[model samples]
Target: MSRETIVLDHLGGHEAAARLIGGRLEDVLIDGAAPRVGTIYRAIADRPVKGQGGMFLRTPDGPAFLRQVRGLAPGQALLVQVTGQAEPGKALPVTQKLLFKSRYAIVTPGAPGLNISRAIRDDDRRDVLMQIARSEMDGGDLGLILRSSCAEGDDDAIAEDIRAMVDLAAAVVADAAGDAEVLTQGDGPHQMAWREWTAPADVITEAGGFEAEGVLDQIALLGVAHVPLSGGASMYVEPTRALIAVDVNTGGDTSPAAGHKANIAAARELPRQLRLRGLGGQITLDLAPMAKKDRRQFEDALRAAFRQDTGETALVGWTPLGHYELQRKRDRAPLEVPQ
Candidate 1:
C-alpha cells in the first residue's frame, strides 16, 4: 500500500502543439495517470478511419506538429491528430503533449517531404525506415524495438524528429479544415525512466503504510537498512536469496561450527542475494552443512561460487535433499532476511 510518483516536469504543449501538428488528444495527464508514451519504433495502419481517416503508423515516441512535412517520401505515408493547453510558461517544460509522433525521420508539410532524413536523404532514411519496417510486416501494427537511443541518431536528432513530424502533419491537415480540439501530446521521457528503475531501499521506505519525500528518496536509494519499526518509523532491510536460507543470528559471534559458521553465512549470503534481490529462478538454498567440508564438494564449491554472481544463473544441481537447485531469474521478491 505504498506507491507514489508525482512528476510535473515541463507539461504544456511543445510550443503550443507546435502550432498544429498531426493531432490527437484525449484524457492525457499531469495529475491523472497513464503516461509512459515513448515508443522507439513499431507502427501500422494502412486504411481505416475513426476521427476522419486512417494511416497512423506512429506508435510511440510521440509528437507530430506540422504546417507541412514531406521529406522522407519514397513509399509515402503521414497522418496526425493534435490538441493543446500544455501549461508551462517561464520558458516551458512540465510534461506537455497533445499527441505527437516522429522521434525519427519523416514529417510532412512537403518542402520535398520536410526531412530528407536529415539531409543525408538516403532516399530519406530509407523511406522512414522502410515505412516503419513495412508497417510491422504488413500493417496491423505493434512491433517497436529500435532504441539504443535510436542508434545512429545524428542529423540533429534526425532533423528534430522531422521538424516534429512536419509541424504535426501541418496541424492535422488544419483540424481537417475547420473547428479544432482532439489532438494531444506529452511524455518527454517519463522522468528518465522513473529515475532509471529506482533503488534506495524501496526508496527510504515505509511498509504496507506509506510516506513521501519521494518515498524517502526511494528508500535512501536502496541500500536498505532503514530500521526503526512499530509505528511512525521505518522497516526495509530486505536481502537474501540466490538459493538462500542463512540462519546465523550469530548473536555474539560465538562459533566452533556454528554450523560451519552457518555454511559461511550461506556462502556469503548467496552473492548478496543474487546481487540484492535481482534474483533468478528455481532457487532453493538451505545451508548449514559443512561438517568440516566435503558436503558434496562443499556444495560443489557453492555451485562454483555462483559463477561470479549468477550472470546467466543456471546452477541446476544439489538436491539429494540438501536443496540448492538454481536455474535462476524468477521475476523477483525474496531478497533476504525474510524468513
Candidate 2:
C-alpha cells in the first residue's frame, strides 16, 4: 500500500513544504521573494497599453498588468488580485476577478450564488452541503463554492470553514476602498500545504522534517537536468531564457521499439518534472525518434499525465520539426538552490 507524507520545514531560511508519496517527492512549495499569487492589492491604474488590451497598475509590490480594462482610467484605485507569477522583468499579472480560496470553500465576491463541487455526485451529500451553505451564506451577494474536500468532511468543521471564508471575504471587500496597498498577502508554504494537500497523509511538522523525509535529497536532484526512466531511458529538462526544453534519450536500449518506449516514458514524466522544478512558460519537447504513427499514442500519454497536474497547461500540438510545444502557467516561483 502506498503511504503519503507531508513535511513542513524550511529550506535556506524560507518556509517550505513537501509531499512524499511512498518515499518519493511528488509536490513542493517554497516561500519566494516575489509577490505571491492570490495576494490582493488596492492598486492605482498607471498607464494603458492599447495594443495589448491591458493596463498597467502601480501596486505596492511593483507594477501589475490587468487585462480587459474597458472603463479603467489612470489614477483610479481599484482592487486586484495576483493571478500568477510574473516572468523575469515583466509586470506581475493581476486580475479584477478575485477568488478567495481555501481547502473546503472558495468565496467569489462579484459572482453571487451557492454551488457544490461537481465531483460530489451523490445527491444526498449534495443536499446536505447545500443545506449547510444556505445556512451559512444566508442569501449573501457573494458566491460560495464548496470544494470537493467537503464530500466526506465533518459537517461541523465544514460549516465552520464556510463561515470563516464568508467572514474573510466580507472583511476584504469592506477594506477595498483604501489607497494603493496590499490588502492581504498570499498563504505561506505551511498554510499552502494545509489548504492544498488535503489527501490522507502522515504530517511531519517538526523541524528538519524535509531532511528526515528525504525531501531535501529529492529536491537536490531538481537542480540537475537528467531524470531516469524505466529500462535505462532518460530525459533532460533544461530551462532557457525563452523556453523550457525537454530531450528524451534511449540509453543502452537496442530494441526496435526503444524510441517509442522512451518517448512515451518521457511524456508521462515530463509534467511531474516540470512541476517539481517550477518551470513554466513555453515548453518544447524533442522526443525520441519514434514513428509518425506513434505520435497519437505519445500525445495521449502526455495528456493523461498532465490531466492530474494542478498548473494550467495547453498542449499546442506538434511543430513543423516534429517537436511538441506547450504553454503552461507560471504558478510557482523557480526553486532556489540552498547554499
Candidate 3:
C-alpha cells in the first residue's frame, strides 16, 4: 500500500508545501517573489507592440503583457489576471480572460454557462452537481464549471465553494472600473496545497515539518542535475537560457536493449523531475542510441507519464537530429535555494 503525505512548512523564509508518495518526494510548491498566477489586477492599457498582437498594461506590480488585444485602446482600464511567471526583466504575462478557480469550482466571468467535468461520467453524480450549480448560479451572466474534485465531494461543501467563487467573481467584476491596482491577491503555498492537493494524505503542519518529513533532503537533490534510474541508467536535466536539456545515458548496462530501457526509464521520470525543480519552457531530450522502431514505444511512455502532470506541455515530436522537443508553460517559478 502506498502512503501519501503533505508537509506544510517554511523554506528560506518563504511558505512551502511538499507532497510525498510512499516516502519519496513527488512535488514541491514554494512562495516566489514574482506575482502569483491568478492574481487579479485592474490595469490601464499602455502602448501596443508593433508586429505583435500583444499590448502592454500598467499595473501596481509592474508592466503586464496581454495578448488578444484586438480593440483595446490606450488608457482604457480593464481587468486582467496573472497567467504565468515572466522571465527576468520581461513584462509579466496577464490575460483578459480571467478565471476564478477553487477546489470544487471555477467561475469564468465573461463566459456564461454551467458545465460539469467530463471525468465525472456518472449521470447521477453529474446531475447532482449540475443541480447545485444551477441553484447557486441562478442564471447569472458568469459561467461555472464543476471541477473533477467535486465528483465524490460533499454537497454542502461544493455548494459553498460555488457560492464563494461566484460572489468573488461578481465583486471583482464590479471593481473593474478602478484605477491600476490589485483587486485580489492569489493564494499562497499553504492555501494552494489545501485547495488543489485533495488526495488522501497525512498532513504535517508543525514547524520544521520539512526537515521532519525528509523533504529538505529531497529538495537538496533538486540543485543537482543527476537523476538515477533503474538498471544503472541515469539522466541529467540541465536548464539553459534558451531551453531545458535532458541527456539520457545507459551506465554500465551492456544489454542489447540497454538504450531502449534507459530511454523508457527517462521518459517515466522526466515529468516528476521537471515538476519538482519547477522548470519549464522549451525542453530538448537527447536520448540514448535507440533504434527507430522503438520511437513509438518511447513516445507512448512519455505521453502516459505526462498525462498525470498538471502543467501544460506540448510534445513537438522528434527533430531531424533525433532529439525530441517539448514546450511547457512557466506556471511555477524556478526553484531557488537559500544561500
Candidate 4:
C-alpha cells in the first residue's frame, strides 16, 4: 500500500491520524489509568490545595493543559500535549469549553475556558496561573480556581509563565521512560477556600478560632461561619413533651457558674448556641431552673434569645424536672448531636 502522510490539525478530505497538530484538533482523553493533576495555575512542589475537597487520580483520566503563544489565534478548541504514562506526546484534542469541571481544569491553545484568561495584568499572579496550567497535564482530580488569576497580569509575568510551561513540558518529556507514574500538584493559598464547599459532610471543625490555613480549609467546608456556637462543655438533650433535658455542664463554656448571675449568663448563652449550631425540632433545654422570679427572667431570656434564631422556636414554661422545654423548627436536617 502507498499513501501520503501529514500531521494535520484540519483536513478537508478523509483524514486518519497518527498525529494531530496546530490549534484545531480532535479532542481525546488521556489513558484511563494515568495520573491526572488538576488544572494548574500555580506552582506547587508540595501538597494538594488546602481544603476539605476530594481529589482522586481516577481511571476515566483527565484532559490536558496547553500553553499559548502570543502571535497565534486559537479556535474554540485546540490540540493539547499529552503527559502520558508510557510516553509523552502532543496535539490531542479536548473540549475548550472546559465543562463537567467539578475540580479539574483544561487549558486551551488560545483563550482558555478557565477563569485565568489572556488579559491578565498582574505579573506575579500571571506567573502563578501559567505555572498552574502546566501542572494540570496529568490526570489528577484536584479542585482548582482559574477565574481571573491572569487578569491584569504584566508581560514579564506572562513570559515567566511561558518559561514555566516549557520547563515543565520538557521535564515530562524527559521522564516519560524512567518513571511512568508521577503525581503533579499545583499551588494553593493556605487552603483552597472555593474548593472545600463542594465536599460531603463528615469532617468536623471543633474548638474555637483556627489558624489562617485552618480558617481557609474550613471556609471551603463550613463556609463563611454565618452562625457559630464554639460548642464546648455542652450536652445533647433528648426532648419530650413531658420534659426537656439539655444537661448544661457547659457548652464548652468554662465560665464559672458560681452565683445566680453567672448561671443566668451561662443559661442565656444556650439560645445563642442553638442558633449558631442551627439546632431545632422540639428541643427540651434541661437548664438549671432558678427562683420564682428567675423563672420569668429565664423565659424572658429565652424570648430574647429566640430573636437571633433563624429557625422557628416556641418556648414552653420550664418542666417539673427543672428542664426548659421548647419547640424549634429545623430548617434543614437536625444535626447529629450525641445524646
For candidate 2, what is the total of clashing residue pairs? Answer: 0
**Candidates, ranked, lDDT:** 3, 2, 4, 1
Candidate 1, residue 26: Cα displacement in angstroms equals: 28
Model 1 scores worst on lDDT over the 10 consecutive residues at 15-24
Candidate 1 lDDT tens digits, 80-176: 3322211212111111112234444433232222212232335655565545534333222112222223334654554455445545545554443
- Scored by CA lDDT, what does every candidate get? 0.35, 0.91, 0.93, 0.36
Runs in model 3 lying further than 4 Å from the true structure: none
Could you tell me the TM-score of candidate 2? 0.97
Query: Candidate 3's residue-wise lDDT over 85-119, tens digit each?
Result: 89889999999888999999999998999999898
Winner by TM-score: 3
Count of clashes in candidate 1 = 87
True lDDT of residue 169, candidate 4: 42
* lDDT: worst 10-residue window of model 4: 23-32
Q: Which scores greater on TM-score, model 2 or model 4? A: 2
- After superposition on all C-alphas, the RMSD of every candidate to the true structure, in Å, is 21.1, 1.2, 1.1, 23.2
The TM-score, computed over Cα atoms with residue i paired to residue i, of candidate 3 is 0.98
- By the lDDT metric, which is better: model 2 or model 4? 2
